[model samples]
Target: MQRILEPGQIEALASRSVPRLRLPDRSRVFAARAERLGALSRGHALQGYLELLATLAAAQHAALQSLEVTLPNESRRAAARHHGMPVIPALGEARSSAWRGVLDALRTAVAAGNYPPAVAAACERLATRSAEALDAQADRLLAVEVAVGDAAAAPLIMAALQVYWVAMAARLVADDVGVPESSGVCPVCGTLPVASIVRTGAPYAGYRYLHCALCATEWHRVRIECTQCSATTGVAYHSIEGGSAAIRAESCDSCHGYRKIFYQEHDPAVDAVADDVASIALDLLLTEAGFHRASGNPLLWQSPG
Candidate 1:
């Protein structure tokens, strides 16, 4: 007869087998993403927007280099751990206002880079906004209130927020993070995943980690499960017929939601964010087929028309 383990026993065994968190590498995460976006832009239908995001990601890398922020104090972290909450929740008063400065730095860096005239003008317009205005937009972005935030400025504001949180996540000791009750959200910042990646290499081979859209933190989750509703029964994977085998949309019939997942085994260079952005057609088809996005990409903001 086969034996089934209880939840606590399963947790205990998985703890020994799987890595809970893969913290962001402040040095190379954004840089590698920028390079990947640039590479994906060539000969693509969304070349202009991809190129713009490439520049924005490069700016994020520059801002991340000198950016500094304080992590939650031991007391806060302890309290969070006790409750199985995120160590550095992006919402509420936990986030540093220094993220505004990171936004300004990104703006300056992006302005210095080569971009289309309209994009340059948009940067100038964003620079003219008051701190309160920027904060309002940022609040909307962080809270996933996408309908009202300035679509033109959301990406820039989000980039700064990313650098702010990534700096903290990169500095975090993975062991310090609490065991989250749910695997759908980021354990570092409590944000939804941009996408999941089946990574290659020792220690993480064949393992799926959900990439946080905000802080770049990656947390391990078992495959073939609904990341949105955590439904295990009706999860399915979809991809473009005859397209790149590396990326696919993981759809859940239970929740009618979907998220893209990348397989590094098919294309070793597949990036969670970059490849997700480069594959808009898959998202369109899934949306048309009645599945909403399970999570959002930082670089892609949709405004209601």
Candidate 2:
């Protein structure tokens, strides 16, 4: 007699070969994001804002070229591996003043581009803020203390922070890190994912990975499960009637939380972060239906009302 396997069991067996984590290519991550943002802005309702983010992403790419960061030592890596925690926990890591220099690089790069007066003014104002104030703002943002952060300045601060972290993550050997027990947060930096992507192509074809909002790490997770609570039941996907076929909101009745998931098969160029922001309408619709977002977009911050 031949043995039979359940679909779930077969899936588990097949998933074993999928790479657990795919670190960002520091050289092209921001550039790809900028290109996607630029494409999304062409005829978008939020064209101006998307374009602004494109400019910021371009700056991030520029800043990243000259950025250098030191990774955690062997002791730290061993400790994190033993405890199933992030190798360089974003919230726990001690930051240096070097990030402020990344911010300056971003400001300089953005200044070279032609932008709206208001946008340029925001960049100028951000540049003039004291180092202490900038550090405080970054702490609030990194901790996801949304209410206390200046919403207008969060994106720029996040851009600089991303450059710093991406530099470290890009340089570190993936073998040095291990998945966290929590499963939902980034294994490299322990930050919430900005969005999840079902990628196309070799090695990762049809594989789903959560795109980290901070360090830009990609970690595999099974599909049709709640990314927040790990619930497998009552999971459904929602999308705008006339929106891009590539994107959808995966809402879980168990957690009542939703995160956008992009299918690269539907659109090969889809970017987890770029498309997440570009499809704000789906978020609004899901919110109206009582499904709250599982995490905030790294490029967009909302002020507390």
Candidate 2 deviant stretches above 4 angstroms = 1-14, 111-114
Tens digits of per-residue lDDT for model 1 on 1-305?
Answer: 99999976986797688777789999999999999999999999999889888888888898889987888889998988888899999887767778889888888877887878866786898889998888888888899884745687778888888888899999888876887888788988899999999999989999899999998999998888899998888898899999999989999999899999999999988888889999999999899999999877888877755
lDDT score at residue 36, model 2, on the 0-100 scale: 94
What does candidate 2's lDDT look like per residue over 1-305, in tens digits?
Answer: 99999987997798789888899898899999999999999989999889878888988998889887877788988888888888877886646788999999887777777777866787888888999899988988999884755676688898899888898889877788876788799999999998899998988998899999998999999999999999999999999998788999999999899999999999988988889988999999999999999999878877766
lDDT by candidate, in order shown: 0.87, 0.87
**Candidate 1: lDDT of 223?**
84
Question: Which residue pairs in candidate 1 have backbone atoms (N, alpha carbon, C) closer than 3 angstroms, thus clashing?
Answer: none
Q: Give candidate 1 misplaced runs (Cα > 4 Å).
A: 1-12
For residue 48, model 1's alpha carbon misses the true position, in angstroms, by 1.1
Residue 216 shift from truth in candidate 2, angstroms: 0.6
